[model samples]
Target: MEITMYDKLLQLPLFQGLCQEDFTSILEKVRFEFNKYPAGSCIAQQGKACKQLIFILQGTVYAKSIDNEHGYVLYETFDSPQVIEPYSLFGMFPQYTASYHAQTDISTVSFNKSYVLSELNKYEIFQLNYLNVISNRAQNVYRKLWDTHIGNTAEKITNFLQLRCTKPAGEKTLQIKMEDLATLIDDTRINVSKVLNKFQEEGLIQLKRKEIHIPALEKLIEQYT
Candidate 1:
């Protein structure tokens, strides 16, 4: 497990352009702390300040945004190797600005923001890599936001599923939920539920406890594009 995890950290694309010494430098200043959260636990609550950018080592997490009438809408799902959901390195405002929940057993390596940015700013390569990461994340999110605004609930669901779900081995399961699905597509729970019901009625999707079984993934993909 130790070898495999370190190998994963070494091979991460976000660290691709950096050198071995860079990682050593990071490890010197940044401490590796294991954060464990149970299923359905809140890792980062809504409207809170975040002091560290955590690199996911295991499990999945869902990002959500709070709303007045609808409670919370699912914003997106984040997998491992992402340092926090979105880096606040250069954001005009440094607050977390959103919340995240553990969808399953979670583990991460968190780094202090001050030390991280300090090391990153010293190196031109690291700076570019950081910029690239932030740029791509914001742009992808913007595109999704644009799509969600124009598309209906069904279209939003399609867009979200395409971005989040992976076809599991053997069985054709997508394995997400209405609640987290709400975040991924940038829609409300009420709206997501309504669309899920619509899809089930049409024999397109199967909804379960925090999981989704899609019998027609290709067809759902067809609906999007």
Candidate 2:
């Protein structure tokens, strides 16, 4: 049988572990609105009141943080059938910490904060999973904070490399721009460029305009990490 959008939603972190019966009930009981955004469109802006819990149903979203000196910093990206800023929906002052833009044509279903919270209280498994999601998000932010404030330039660059390095088409590489890296890591473009050059000279990485191919990611990681 072909999987439905409802089935895909059950696979998400927030909705995982829910049986079909319960999932159906929640869908019928809760109120949500679907929204579509074209490619390169802004889904949500930073510091805006987060009144709804948005779940992406299609395409990709690129999240960015505003930097006073460096402009917008690319923080992360998320793909379809996933939640966006669940943590921001709660707390004393709820606001999106980063702006999200559609990387491609995207669709989302959003649940009002009051309704989602009501469901959370009614469902134990959903509540636990929601806590897990928020906890994991918090941990990531904490780690990023440690890396940015405490780690040195070399550490920062290496950490960035470790986090972003991926093997696509069986080739190990990081297809990222130097300027984007600088902005993401809150480092100067010159410093980021210099470190990448040093890594290249040391036979650690091969640099292209927007791609950094690591000969052996383990070796590169071991040197600094």
Most accurate candidate by lDDT: 2
| 1-225: candidate 2 lDDT, tens digit per residue | 114767768878888898888877887888868789999998889899999888889898777665555332334556677787788888987998778889899988888888876775699998898899888766765665566524766678777644432211112555566887787788888988998899899998788767777656667667776
**Candidate 1: tens digits of C-alpha lDDT, residues 1-225:** 545556657555456676667766766666667678887887776556667766777888766654445333334565665456446534666666556678778877666668666665686776776678788766766665566545887887776555432221112344454676677567799998887888778887777775566665667666554
- Against the correct fold, how does model 2 do in TM-score? 0.71
Report RMSD (Å) for each prediction in the order shown. Answer: 6.4, 5.7
Residue 220 shift from truth in candidate 1, angstroms: 3.8
Model 2 clash pairs are none
Alpha-carbon shift of residue 109 in model 2 (angstroms): 1.1
